[model samples]
Target: MRKTPARTRSTSRSRAAVVAVAIAAIGGTTLVGSPASAAPSGDTTQFKGVNWADPRDNYADDPVVLSGLSTSDTYAQTYAKASRVISAFRANLGANTVRLPINPYTVNGPYWKSYRGVIDAATAHGFKVIVSYWEGTGARKDGFIDDPATYWPMWNTVVKAYKGNSRVYFEPMNEPHGYTDTEWADLAVKWLGTYPSVPRNRVFVSGAGYNDHVTSVCADPRLKGTYLSLHHYGFWKEYATYDQWVSDLKERIGNCASRTVADEFGAPMTTGLDYNKATPDNNSINFIQADTDTFRQLKMGSVYWPGLRTDDTYSLQKLIGNAARPWLATTNQSGADRLAWSWGRGKPVSP
Candidate 1:
């Protein structure tokens, strides 16, 4: 998710504090600092992950087929390209998980038939895939869910398609910006009820306010089995010190580390910054280090944003000339190094 105005982040933080205080005043346990349920093996806080985008971009909602994959091709044929990319992820970054953004409208339409191939290919390659909804223009224009009529059905189709696949995870919505903490929790519960057959562990419930803050979501007992989805970008607070960033990140997790995943976090790949250096010269590097350190200390997993994208600055991989699949790009050596170091050389754990 793109960074919003500074005021928005400040406001969200303020609101989170207020809600936290209210919960405390009522003699309710905040669940803050509580021990989190253990994550899947190999899926510890150090599990390396990346976000792979469709070649068409525009949030993966475009009606046209992506370059490597053909519209008329069989599932096997379309998945060949994905397999190549997944291989690169393993060989180059030691990444085990990939978070994919799905256009809500495309699921039940022509897109669904072909998209299933991508998910199947990722799982076949031993990678955990997270599929989340992104409302085309709504995502950029308002970041809110404006229509349940279309939204609910899209998810219904998603659950039915991958409910039985353990490697495939369900993220109800990408960033529920319009809903209050309680409202998002309500919707998550509703979604859980809607697909009773899908285990709670397979669902990723996003934190409130652009999936930035999870204190409220963690406090909800009904969301127990589900992992918390969090998105943090260095640009969100361009000037924060490493110490401040670390503190803020921990605050955001709110004691739900074990069951939390930083599914979306990134920095500028073109900056040529050294992640190991703890200086103030590069906030992106600092952000990467802070998050890596925080997740490591807390034993939470993370997926870097944009493992591949057409012209994104934070993409870990860039498409080779005319090649549909992506290869590791050299531009973000520091970011790549940090991810590899965090992930280590061990086999990736299935989420």
Candidate 2:
């Protein structure tokens, strides 16, 4: 999983009359007492440029409340759980986006048959799938995958499942955060499987340092076809010293790839609820707070970490993008990279 966003402090709100007019004109909805302002309506179009998993409703702040997770509890049950996850967020059911982090075990293990089932359900719903996976979470898994060389096979299989579907965007890994250029060389370019008309170009891989995709690893020629990803949080102010924090966190990527997105970023569960109590007035006003705007402009697309946790994470979601939170229209698709989705009616649920 990627790091989440930080929470913002909010004290007041505009009059009910103002909210009414904004909602009516913009098809508006917002999180209460959050930075009160305009919101894009349900008619707010979904992700524009790339298609990946971002069903805010899935376990966060979506319209349709999602259910079932026993299958995802363990690798043995991954196929079963993955099936339910995809089924729960079907596209035709009004779920246009999904966050399917590919489970290599379930995809290549004995339960592999069930992995295909998830893809079938995705096609049924018309979702623009984002297939991401988490590997050993280490520098590299040097051993050859003899038991399950499912990498190429999975790609070919998933692409074929959609019947030449263009909505699917394959993300190779979750956080290749600390990897060297050579580490990604194999997955990015040299693979053993055949294409079978599948588009390897659609497969995206994370860059270095968690989700700092553009700054660290997007330069490899082998990674020519894929996009980059980034992650940040509004709470950075609470931890690091401003002198060391602001400059390091503000890694500028003047434009490296065809597309780059803030895969995750938001406040913590603790701060969101008592944000006013925790974040100092001075800290809140620091440059760390500039992330939202800087990211919105630099990445061109952003998806805040979910405020809605498996339990009640609204404390955190409120600072990100939640209809219940009432922040600006700077979510799944409201701002840029062209992929973020907005809170809307009939949207699926997060948890």
TM-score of each: 0.82, 0.53
Model 2 lDDT, residue 244, Cα: 39
Error of 1 at 202 (Å): 0.6
How well is each residue in 137-197 modelled by candidate 2, as lDDT tens digits? 2223211121134445655555565537776666655654333434444443433123324
Worst 10 residues of 1 by lDDT: 26-35
lDDT of each: 0.69, 0.39
RMSD of each: 7.0, 16.9
lDDT of 1 at 64: 32
Model 1 ranges off by over 4 Å: 3-47, 55-74, 138-140, 321-330, 344-351
